[model samples]
Every structure is written in structure tokens, then in C-alpha cells.
Target chain A: MRWSLLGTAVVLLVVFLMSQRQQIEVSYGQSPSSPDAVVEGEAGELSEATVPSVEAMTAMIDAEPVVRLPGSIARWNERVVREAIGDSDIRILVAPPGLDEAERGRVREVERATITIVGTKVSGGVYEATADAIPEWRAQFASGDVTTLLVPMIRHLQERESPAVDASFRWREPTAAELDTVTAELRANGSHVAEGATLEGVPEASEKAFPDAEALYVALPRQPFGQPVPRYGPALARTFPDRPIVVVYGSWIEYDGPGAADFAELVSAMFYAQFGTRLATYDYPQGNVLNAWLNRVTDVRYAGLFDRPLPYLPFDPVKVTMPALPWLFAACVAGFLALSARSLRRPQAARDSRHYSRLAGLTALAIEVSGLSGERSDPPLTRGIGKLRAATEALESGLPPAQVRTLLDDAENELDDTARLLGRRDYRPRNYLEGRLG
Target chain B: MSASWSVWLVGGVLLAAAGVGSTLVPRLRARGVRRRVAWSTARAAIDSAAVSRDACATRVAEAERLLARAESIAADRGGVLAAEEAARCAERADRLWRAARRG
Candidate 1:
């Protein structure tokens, strides 16, 4: 039993560790083709070394509507349009009202069919147009949702489409209370969003300010074509190794329009997307919004923005719930330990009882031998000796201590009665002899 | 089954087996052997008492009956107390046999 229990415990520990190792392998096994896939260029746009060609980007976008754009402004535009349109089959056409026919034609020629850059008059299957670019397009087609890359317009579109989708799905600028709730949730989930570390000035400032933060959230203002965006991700990662640096680059208007609420959600989505893959690791029951976003925009390449050790996930494992069988086995082990303990205890108790029985048998034999003639002459004497013998046998037969003790007691009484009849007071049983000797 | 689930299931079975096989079976087997040996010893002693011509016929018969009872207990594998009682029965029968032969 001892060996069994020890072996079982050891095996269980090994199995648990093996399972955890497998899970860890599944999570961190994939090595990215390159350690750093994306390198920021002079203007904080993707450098030529990292940026996908227009043809490749177009091909990828055609296959799956998600693409990691070259510039922060472009990604920001993609994020807004993608968020506003959601999982619906609607294609968002990004064309400024200022662009003329020749440029529009070139844009059309480049994109093929996924999203054509068109002038004011928009016509398509199902599409969303910026309110500023297409004022008359909505009047022409009642099937499309119009958004102006602003929170109010996005919120309006959401309100209009809320009935067809989940009513709770609202894409508006989060309030202060909402931001607090999200921040609290993130903290609970072991993600400390360094509040003031927006990387507005330099990466060194954030490193000094939020040294202990697990992740640095940098919301950079969009840089002009000539102006360089402050590349903070690499610098922040160097300052804090194995920590995530989320840099969401957006136009100044995008930041002011959607406000902290949307940025907070996006940051959280990206944070969880990088770190916590299992919902069991979190307190929440629902699926992550970021996972849904990734699934919807299936082909978005994560360009090593956060210095992630593992490649970006296709999607996180939903939830890992332990089976009932393991728990049952654990319970059985506990029960076995208990039974083993009882079994170990039983032998000692039985040995003690056996010792007493032996002494009693030997003592009774002595009394009978000494008074054999009296035992034969007197019927009660003979009967008492016989009863004593019976008691001893019963004791040997593994009766319970209490029952054997009772039988011994009865035998002792019978022997005492016979002793009285024989006018002798020295024939005491083993129990009395024990008490006297002790 | 998933890898983790398989591990758990296999581990659980091993634990249950260890509990039953290591603790329960050996203890029971030891008890059974104890009772059987003790009862056979008692019967042998009673048979020896029956062999002696000077032994009291009534006492010898009574001891033989006691030996039979001990045999029943041994067959039943009554436990530690029953084995002890069987041992005591054997001892008593031996005493009777010796006393009768001495006479």
C-alpha cells in the first residue's frame, strides 16, 4: 500500500506535468520565420524590407479582407472601417472626395474587385462609405451603412444595425466609467495598461514612468508622409524584456473622434491576442472580442510589433476544462490511502488481541491442570473449564475485541463460580492477572 | 480522447488498482492463511486427544466439536479475532490432549 500510494502520487504528478508541457508546447511551439518581421521606415511606415508589395497586399486582401497596412494611418483607417462594418459582407471603400477620375481609376485598377476607390457616386453589392466622401451615395443606395471614421457616425451606424446583430454590440467612444471597467478587467487579467505611457514624447519617458508595467500601451498620433513616427515598440521592449508593447498609430482626428473607450478595447484585444490564449486563464466566460476580430479578418499578419516570442495565433483555444475522471481518481487515491492506513492499523490491533488470547489460554490451561481432579469431580468445574476453552477458541477465531472480551468475561465468571465451589480463590483469568501484575 | 484526458484516465485507473491490490488483497490473504492454519492445528490436537485411550471420552469429544467450530471460522476467514480464537482453541485442545496422555 505504501509503495502503491507513493507510486500513484508520483505518476499523477508526472501525468499532470506532461499534460501541461503539451499545452505549453501547443502555445509556444511555433517559431516565427523571422525574429523581427516588421521594421519601421523613416516616416514610421513599414520599411521596404518588411512591407508587402502592393500586388501581394492586394492579393492577400482579395483572399481575406484583412491586411497589415504600411502606414499607421492606413491601419487606423482599416481598423475603424473593419470595426464599423463588423463581420457583415459589406466592403468599406476608402476614397477621399478630393481624388479625381484618373486617380480613382488607378485605385480601381489596383484593387480589382474587393474595394474600388470611387468618387462621390458609390454603387456596389453591400458597402460602407465615409460620410464626408459620399453624401449622395446613401440617398442612392439604402442598403449601405455610412460612417465618417468618427465615433458618433460609427455609433449611429451601430445603432441602425443593432437590430439585425447583437443589440449589445455598440461601437462608440467609451465613457470614463467604461474605461475604468475595462482597465480593472485588464488588471484582473494580469495586464497592467500603463495609463500615461502613450509614448507622446519618447520611449525613455514611458520606460521611466511605468517601469513595472507588464505591457506598454502607446497610442501614437499619425505622422505625415515626410515626418517620422516615434518608433517606441523596439525601445520599450528593450527596456522591459519579455513585456508587450502595443503601439496603435492613428490620425489625430481618429484619436479625438473614437476617444479612450475604443482605444482601450483595441489595446485589450491586442494584449490578450498576444498573451492569454486560454479563457481558463481569465475570469471572464465570454470569448475575447480580439479573437472574433482575428477570425473575421482571417489573414491579418502580425508583423512582430510587440516583440512576441511566438507567432500570432490563428485563434485562442476556447477553454480547457478538466475532466471529472481525474477528480474521481484523486478521490479514489484518498480513499485508498485511508483504507491502507486502516489495514496497517488492523494487524497491530489483531496482534495485541492475539497476545491477550494466548495469555488467557495459557492461564486457563494452568488453572485447569492444577485443579484437574476438582474439574472432573464437580460438573460446574468441568463446565467452567469447557466454557473457558470455548472462549479461547472464539477469541482465536478473530471475533471483534468487544465480543471476544465479553466471551472471556463470561468464561472468567464461570471459572470464578467453579473456584468458589472448590473453595479456592487463586484461579483468576488473564484479564484479572493483567490488572494484578500491572 | 485528448492527450490530457487520456493521461488523467490512465492515471486514475492506476491509483484505483494500487489501492485495491496493494492494501486490500494482501491483508485478506494473510487473514485467510492465519485462520486456516490455526483451525487445522486445533483439529490435529483434538485428533491426538482422541488417540489416547486414557483421555476422557466426553472432553475429547467436546474438543473435537470445538475444533470443528474453529474450522468453520477459518473457512469463513472471520478476521484477526477469529484467527486468535482458533489459535486459542488449538492451544486448549493441545492442553487436553497432553493432560489425557499424562494421565
Candidate 2:
């Protein structure tokens, strides 16, 4: 029985694991064509005439000034560039510090027409990289270009040395028009909006807006400058790691010159990084690929993100059914063991009863023989009966069977003598013979 | 699935395996114990019964021989009634011995 129960449990476990494997395969093994269509559809109708070759985009970037960003942002930018160019040879230059003259020569030797590195110089004890080659790389105030910007404001604040330009004094709350624009965009994208007094209130407001929302959509107030800040994104991400957060920036922010496209690309990448596939219908071609790939991977990881059981927190109670199967299996095993124990005990119990019955039968036999011998009125026979009765009492008192058997043997000898004497017709009592002779 | 859910699933499986092992191990031990006890009891009962049967067989043979001797003695004395009574007693003893052997 236990073996059968174990076999059933093993079968159930195997079936469950196989089903999970199949689900993983179905989700991750799908062809990229359907996603490509979805991506292209999201980008709107594009004519073949308007699509430029990868060579063209690389050439354009090489002619313009280099856009320097942190490694993470750079990687995201490269992905977007690849999506836009489609199989063209392109390379983004990354200039790490402490490169000697020999290493610099090596870099130049490897440099292709597609590569360009932004150089840095020390200014006022702080490292300042030159953005002069590209008009977009120039500081925003100097060029009056809405498209140009500096480092992520949060990183600038965290640095040991201050930047050449300070934008802290320029920080201000969003104007009513700016708020209206952002709120409209979010509403169009199917998000629940909750107004908060400050940036810190975003989480609480989101919670209040839709208590059972699967994801949180936060429309950040515009920065002092048109450029995006690094602090808000990382802060919100840290605060709510369990749920997906979508930070919506106002579309009215302008980007001028070569920096315009770069800034737009950066913003789109930020949205992708924060919310994965839910891009909120942003007007960018790269968003299609980014959203599609993210959708597949995230969907594989989180199988049911937006189903019933609203207010999807990090741990959804509905998805916690995995333990039940194993527990049921364990219960069956336990029950099987219990039955086996009972069965195994049965034979032992029966044996004990047989022992008791045998002992009882022997005692009854001794008592019956003693009663038959008692019919003779002889004193010796009576004495023997008394001895037999005592032995029977001893057996009933838990005496060893061997000792009781010895007592029965002695009693049997006495009974046998009484029977033989009774069989002799000529036998006489001693006292009667003496009286006759006198 | 999230890492927590995966952790929980693996932990649950391990726990169930442990439970099965715990239950099976003790039951197997108990089965061994019961088997040994039953085997010993059966052995003792067989031995005791055989001894009792042998003893009864001897008693039956002795009683038959004694009955023959008593009949001869009674015939020599011309006491037919005494021989008949002695034969009845011997027969009763023989029956009792047979019953004991059966037991």
C-alpha cells in the first residue's frame, strides 16, 4: 500500500514538473515574427522610402558629436540604435579613464568610421567632458537648445565634486498646463491618476488611486530643465520593486539640434526600463521591439500579471497553490503507513490470544480430571484433588507453564493410583480389616 | 514566477519527501518487529503442541498394555465382571489421553 501511494506521489510530481516545463517552453519558444508585427504596428505606418539604412544612421552619428552616458544607459541606447539601423555595422565608443598612451593608440587603431569618443578635461578641479563636436552635447543654457542636457542630475548630486553648471536653483513645481498635459497623456494610456503634493507622495497616491491596480503609473512633474533627472526614476524604482512603475514625462519638453533625438531615445529607454512592455503608446519606432521582447520575457517570469485577484502586490495569494499538491501527497503516504502498521500488528495480536487460550484450556483440563478423581471418597485422592486445585490457581496467577505442567503430572499420578485401587474388588479399608481380626 | 514562489515550491517538495520518509521508516521497523514476534510465538506453540502430543501417545500405549494385563489376570481368577470394569476404566483413560494428544 505504501509503495502504491509513493508511486502515485512520484507520478503527480513528474506530471506537475512536466507541465511547468511545457509552459516555460511555450512562452519562451515562440517565434519573433508576431512580436515584430506588434512592434511595427505600434510604430505606426512607415513607408519603405522613409526607412534609412543602418549605414546611414551610423554615418549620421559619426558626423555629429558623441553622446556620453553611463554604461547602463549606453547599453540601452545601443539596443535602440540597433533596432533602428537593422543589421548595419555600428559601434558606440566608451572611454574609460586611466588609458595610457599605448592603450589610447590601440583604441585609435581599432576605431572605425562608426566610432567617436567624447574627450574629458579638468575644469575647476572637476572633470568636464567636451560636447563641442555635437551641438546637442553643449550645455542647455549655452545653446538655448531644448534638446541638449547634462549628466543625470541625481548622479551629479552624488559626485564628490560639483558640476560646472548647477541646476538646483532652477528647480520648480510643474505649471498647471504641464500637469494637464501629463495627466491627459496618462489617461489616454489607460492609467489611474492620483495627485500628490510632493514627489515622495507618489507611492501613497498610487496606492490610493487604485488599491487593486496590478501596476502603478506615476506621472513625474517636469524637471527645471527639459532634460530628465536620474534621482526620481531610481527612487521610485527602489520604493516599489514589487510592482511595475511607469514614470510619464510631459511631451511638451522640447529637444533641439542633434541632442533632440538622443534625449527622446533616452526617455523612451527609461520608460522601457521602468515598465518593461507597457510603453504607454510612445511615438518611437524602437519601442515596438523593446516592448515585444520585454513582454515575452516578463510574461514568462510572471505568468499572470493582470488577471483576477485585483490589487496585485508582490505576493499574490491566488498564486500560492503550489504547496497544496505536495501536502496532499504527504497525507496519502501517512495514511498508507498507518494501515500497514495496523496490518502488521494483527498477527502478533492473534498469536497473543492463542497463547492465552492454550493456557486456559490446560487449566480447564487439570480441573476436570481433579473433579473426576474427587468422586472417590479416599483421603489420598481428596488430597491429590486439593493439590491439583492449588496448581490450577497457580497457573491462573501467571505461573510459568512448565511449573504448572509439573504440578498436573503429580496430580495425574495420584488420580491414576486412586483409579487402580477402585478397580480392585478385593481391596478393603485398613481400619475395617483390623476390626474384623480383633 | 517570483523567486519566493519558487523557493516555496521547492521547500514544500522537500518537506513532503521528509514526511514520507519519516512515516515509512518507522512503519518498516514496526513490521520487522511484528514479524519477529509472530515467528517466535508460532515456533513455541508448535514445539509445545508436539511435546504434549508425544506425551499423550505414550500414555495411550501404556493404558492399552495395562488393560491387556488386567483382562488376563481377571480371566485367571474367573472374575468376568472385574475384567469388564477394568477394561472400561482403561478405555476411558485411553480416550482422555487421545483427547490430550489432539489438544
Write down the worst ten-residue block by lDDT for model 2 chain A.
Answer: A140-149
How much is the lDDT of residue A256 in candidate 2?
Answer: 19
Q: What TM-score quantifies how close candidate 2 is to the native fold?
A: 0.28
**DockQ of candidate 1 compared with the true complex:** 0.08
Fnat of candidate 2, please?
0.00
Candidate maximizing TM-score: 2
Compared with the true structure, what per-residue lDDT tens digits does model 2 show for residues A334-391? Answer: 6655755565553422223433443344344334444544333243354345445545
Query: Chain A: TM-score in each candidate?
Result: 0.26, 0.29
Expressed as tens digits, the lDDT of each residue in A1-438 for candidate 1 is 655656666665665555554443332433222222222221232112223344754675566553333321221233455666676544333343223334434445545344432322232324433332222111111111222322233445355542221111112233556445434643465233234222232232233322344444434322332223344444434444655444443211111111223243454344333432221111111112222222222112223233434444565342233344355456546766676657555453354555485446645544664554463334334444554565566556655455445545544555565555555555545444665566
lDDT of 1: 0.41
Question: For each candidate, what's the DockQ?
Answer: 0.08, 0.03
Candidate 2, clashing residue pairs?
A147-A255, A147-A256, A212-A311
